[model samples]
Target: MSDALDQLKRHLAPIIRLQQIDGLLSWDQQTMMPPKATTARAEQMAALESLVHELFTSEKTAVLLAKCESALADAAPDSDEVRLVRVTRRDYDKETKIPATLVEELARHQALSHEVWVRARRENNFSLFAPALEKMFALTRQKAEYLGYRHHPYDALIDLYEPGMTYADVVALFDSLKPALIALVKNISEAERQFDDSCLQGDFPVEKQHAFTQEIVQALGYDLTRGRQDPAPHPFCSGFSRDDVRITTRFDPHLLVKALFASLHEAGHAMYDQGTPEAYEATPLAGGTSLGVHESQSRFWENMVGRSYAFCKWILPHLQKVFPDPFAHLNALELYQAINRVQPSFIRVEADEVTYNLHILLRFELETQLLEGTLSVMDLPDAWNAKMQEYLGITPPNDTLGCLQDIHWAGGLIGYFPTYTIGNLLSAQLREAMLHDIPNLETLIEQGEFSSILQWLRQHIHVYGRKFLPQELVILATGKPLSADPYLTYLQTKFKELYAL
Candidate 1:
C-alpha cells in the first residue's frame, strides 16, 4: 500500500511540473512576450497543452490512481494519501472526458484570441474582437457538452475551476445578493454627504508607484526572495511553485489607488501560494483548493486589510514619502474616506467595493446567456451597457469600457467572473472569524504588523492547500457555512457609517 501511494505521487509529479511550465509560458505571454510572437506562442502553447492532456489522461495514470485508491481504501478519508488519490481521481475523470484535440485547439485559440482582445481594447473596436469571442463561446460550448452537465452547459465549465459548484448554485447566490447591493448603491447615491477622493489622484509617476507597491507588498509579508512583481496588460498573480510565485500589475500614473490596491490583491494571492505546506509541492495537493477560495485570499488583503482605516493610517506616511504632492496633506481618516469612496465605474477592476458584486452579476448573467444562446457575441456590448445602467445607473459609452474591458473571454475564462464575488463574500466571512480570534487585528494593521495575521491564515486556511474542498475549508476555518449575510452586513455597516445614511 505504501509503495502504491509512493508510485502514485511519482507518476503525478512530471505532469504537475508540465502544467506549471504551461502557466509560466502564459505568464510570459501576458507580461513579456512581443506583439509579433502571438502566432508562434499559440502553436507552442497548443503543442504543450496537447502533450500534457495526453500524459495526464493516459492509461498508465489511470492504473496508478486505481492502485493507490484500492491500497488506501481502509485509510482515514482525511489523510493526505486518501485526499491525494481522491483529488487526482476527480481531475483525471474530468480531463479524460475531453479529447486532446479540443484541448489543443482551445489553447491555440486562447493565445490568438487574447492578442485580438488586447488590440481591440487598445483600439476601442469591438467588431475586431467579435469573431474571436464568437469562436471562443463555440469552443467552450463544445467542451461543456463533452463534459456533460445535467442542468446547464455552463455547469461543466464552472466546475473545472470550482469543484462541486453548479450553475444553479451561482444563480441562487447572485439572486440573494442583487437586491441588497442595489439598495446599497441607491442609498449611497442619495446620501446627503459625499466624499472627495481628489487626494487619491495626482502626478503619481510610474517608477515611484512601482517602488511604493513593492515596499507595501513586502511589508505585508510577501517574501521578495521567493517572489517578484512585474507590469502586465492586466494585473495577475502566477505561482509556478512556492518559491517561484510572480505577480504583475498595471499602473495608472494619475491614480495611485489603482496600482496600490492591485499590488495588494495580487500579493494576497502570492502569499497564499508561498504559505502552502511544502509537502504538497508538485502534487495534486499543491496550489489553491479552488479559484473561489483563492479569490478570497486576494480580496482579504486587497479590501479587508488594504482598504481599511487601519491600513490607511499605516500607509499614509509611506504614501506621503513616495508621492509627496497629494498625500502629504492627507490625514489618515481623510485618506480612508478617499480610498473607500463609493462610486459606480466603467472598469470592473476599478469598481468600488459597494458596487463590485454588481459587475460580477452582470458578467454572470451574460456568460449564462452566451452559453444558453440567448445572447449573441455581436450584441454583447449592448447587453453589457444595458446591465451597467440597470445595475449601477450608468452606461458605458464604448465597447472598450463595456465588453472589452476584461481579458477573461479572450482567454477562454467564461465561468471565471463569479469567483471574484465568491472571493469577496468569503473574505468578509474570514475577516469576521479572524476578528473574533485576534481582537487586535485592526491595531496590528495600523501598526503595520502582518505576521500574526498571516500566521492566523496560515494556521487555518493556507496550510491545507488542496487537501479540502472550498466549502469544507470555509466551514472549518470560519466555523460556519458560507452565507451572504456576513458580507452584506459588512458592506451595509461600513457604507452607512461612511455616507451617514
Candidate 2:
C-alpha cells in the first residue's frame, strides 16, 4: 500500500507543476502580457488545461486512488497526504464524468473571454462581450449539468471554489443578512456626510501612486523578494506559491484612494499566500484552501488592518513623505475616517465595506434569476440598473459602471459574488477572535507590527491549507459557526464612529 501510494504521488506531482506553470502564465497575462500575445496565450492555456485535465482524470489514477484510500485509512484525516488524496479523488471523480473535450473547450473559451472582458470593459460596449458571455454561460450550465447538482446549476460552480457549499445554503444565509444589511444602510442614508474626502483628490501622479503602494505593502509584510506588484486594467491578486505571489492594481491620477486601497487589498492576499506552510510548496496543499477563504484573508488585512485607525497612524508619516501635497495635512484619524466612510457605489471592487455586501447581494440575486431563466441576458442592463437604483438609490449611467463593471459574469464566474460577503463575515469574526486572544493587536498595528495577527491566522487558519472546508475553518477560528452578527456589529461600530451615526 505504501509503494502504491508513492506511485500515486509520483503521478500527481508533475500535473501540479503544470498547474503552477499555467498559473504563472495567467499572472503574466493579467500583469505584463502585451496585446499581440493574447491569441497565443489562449492556445497555450487550452493545451495545458487539456493535458492536465486528461492526465489528472486518467483511468490509471482511479486504480492508484484505491491504494491511496487504503494507505490513508490509518493516517490522520487532517494530514496533508490525506487532504491531498481526498480532494484529488473528489476532483478526479467529477472530472472523469465530463468529456475531456468539454473541459478543453471551457479552458479555451475562458482564455478568449478574458480578452473579451477587457475589450468590453474598455469599449464600454456590452454587445462586444454579449456573445462571449452567452457562450460562457451556456458552457457553465452544461458543466453544471455534467457535474450534476441536486438543486441549482450554480451550486456546482460554487462547490468548485468552496467545497461542500450549495446554492440553497448561500440563499438561506443571505436571506438572514438582507434585512439587517438593508436597515443598517438605511440608517447610514440619514446620517450627514460631514467628511469631505477631497484631500484624496489632488495632483497625484501614477508614479507616486505605484511607489507609495509598494512602500505600504512592504511595510504591511508583503515580501517583495517572493511577490510582485503590477498595474492592470482591473485589480486582482493571484499566487502560485508563497514565493511567487502577484498582485495588480489600477491607478487614477485624479482619484487617490482607488490605487492605494486596492494595493492594500491585494497585499492582504499576498500576505496570506506568504503565510502558507513552506512544506506545502509545489503541491495542492501549498496555496489557499479556496477562493472564499482566500478572500477572507485579503479583506481582513485590507479593511480591518489597512483601514483601521492603528494602520492609519502607522502609515501617515510615510504617506506625508511620498505624497506630501495630498496627505501632509490629513491626520491619521482623518484618513481612517475618510477611507472608512460608508457610501453606495456601482463597482463592487471600489465599494466601501458597509455597502460592498449589498453589491454582492444584488449580483447574487441577478445571477440566480439569470440561471433560472426568469431574467433574460438581453435585459440584464435594465435589471442591473433597477437593482442599482433599488439598492443604492442611484442608477448606473452606463453598462460600464453597471453590468460591464465586473469580469466575473463575463468569465462565467456565476455564484462567486456571495463569497465576498462570506469572506467579510468570516474576516470580522476571525478578527474578533484574534483580539480576544491577543489584546494588544491595535497597539501592534499602530507600531507597524503584524506578528500577533499574522501568527494567529497562520496557526488557526493558514496552516491548515485545504485540509478542511470553509465551514470547518470558520468553526476552528471563531468558536461558533458562521454568523452575520460579528460582521454586522463590526460594521455598525466602525462606521458609526467614522460617520458619526
Candidate 3:
C-alpha cells in the first residue's frame, strides 16, 4: 500500500506542478500581462491546459490509481492514503471523459473572453464582448455535457468547484433563504439610513492604501516572506504552493472600504493556502477544498472580522495616520457603522454584508438561465438590470455595473456565484463556533491580535486542506451541518441595533 501510494504521489506531482504553472499564468494575465500579449497568453494558457489535461487523464495515472486503490482496500476509510486515492480517482474519471481538445478550446476561449470582458467593462459595451461570452457559454455547455450529470447540466459544472453539491441542493437552499433576505432588505430600506459613510469619501492615495493594506495583512499573519500582494482589476488570491501564495486588491481613491476589505478578503484566502501542511504540497490536498469553502475564509475575514466594530477600533489609528484629513474626526464606532452601512450597490464586490447575497442570488439565477439557454448573451444586461431593480430597487445604467462587474463568467465560472452566499452563511456559522470557543475574540481583534483566530482556523479548517469535503469540514468545525440560521441571526441582531429597527 505504501509503495502504491508513493507511485501515485509521484505521478500526481507533475500534474500539480502544471496546474501551479497555469495558476501563475492566470495571475500574470490578470495583473501584469501587456494588453497586446493577450493572444499569445491565450495560446500559452491553452497549450498548458491541454498538457495538464493530457497528463492528468493519461493511462499511466489510471493504472497508478487502480494500483493504489487495490493496495489500500483494507486501509482505514478516512486515512490520508485512502482519501488521496479517492479524490484522485474521482478527478481522473471526470477528466478522462472530457476530450483534451475541448479542454484547450475552453481555456483559449476563456482567456480571450476575459480580455474582451476587460475592454467591454471599461467601455461599458456588452455588445463588444457578446460573441466571446456566447462562445464561452457554448463551450461550457459542451463541457458539461461531456462531464455528464444526473439532474441538470449546471450540476456538472457546480460539482467541479464544489464536490457533491447539486443544482437541486442550491435551489433548495436559495428557496429557503429568499423570503428572509427580501424581508431583511425591505426592513432596512424602510428605515432611514442611520449612518453617514461620507467620511469614507476622500482622496486615498493608491500607494498609501497599498502600504496600509500590507500592514493589516501582515498583522493578520499573511507572511510577506512567503506570499505577496499586488493590484488587480478584481481582487483574488492564487496559490502556486503553500509558501507561494499571491493576493491582489484594487484601490478606490474615493472609497476607503473597497481596497481595505478586499485586501483582508484576499488575505484570508492566502492565509488558508499558507497554512496547509507542507507534507500536502504539490498534491491534490495542497489547496482549498472548494470554491464555497475557500470563499468562507475570505468572507469570514472580510465581513465577520474586518467589518466588525473591534476591527474598526484596531484599524482606526492606522487610518488616521495614513489619511489624517479623512479619518481625523471619524472615531472607530463611526467608521464601523460607515463600513457596515446597508445600502444597495451596483458592484457585488462592494456590496455591504446585508445586501451582498442578493447580488449573488441575482447572478446565480442569471447564470442558471444562461446555462439553460433561456437567457442569451445579448439580453444579459437587461435581465441583469431587471433583477437588480427587483432585488435592490436600483438599476445599473450600463453593462459595466450591471452584468460585467464579475470576472467569473468571462473565466468560464458559470456555477460559482452561489458560493459567495454559501461562504457568507458558513462564515457566520464559523464565527459563532469561534466565539463559543474564544469568548474574548472581539477584544483580541480590537487589540490587533489575530494569531489566536488564525491558529483556531488553522487547526479546525486549514490543516485538513482538501482531505475532507466541505460538508464534512463544516460539520467538524461548527458542530453542525451548514445552515443559514447563524448568518441570518447574526445579520438581524447586528442591523436591528445599528438601524434601531
Residue 220 of model 1, lDDT score:
93
Residue-level lDDT tens digits of model 1 in 357-455: 999999999989998899998999889999999998899988888989999999999899889989999999999999999999999999999999999
Candidate with the larger TM-score of 1 and 2 = 1
What TM-score would you give candidate 3 relative to the actual structure?
Answer: 0.99
Checking candidate 1 for backbone clashes, the offending pairs are none
Error of 3 at 72 (Å): 0.6
Tens-digit per-residue lDDT, 1-501, candidate 3:
888889889989988999999999999999999999999999999999999999899889989988998998999998888888888888888999999999999898888889999999999988998999898889999989999999899899999988899999999888878898889888987987677788889998899889999998999999999999999988999999998999999988888678888999999999999999998998887788988999999999999999899999998998889899789998888998899888898999989888888888898899999899999988988899999999999999878888888999899998888888889999999999999999999999999889999999999999999999899999999999999899999999999888888
| Order of quality (TM-score) | 1, 3, 2
The residue ranges of model 1 lying beyond 4 angstroms of the native Cα positions read: none
For candidate 2, list the clashing residue pairs, or say none: none
lDDT by residue for model 2 (205-308), tens = 89988888898888777899998888988888888767888899999998878988899889878888887888776666667777888889889988888889
- Model 3 residue 410 CA deviation in Å: 0.7
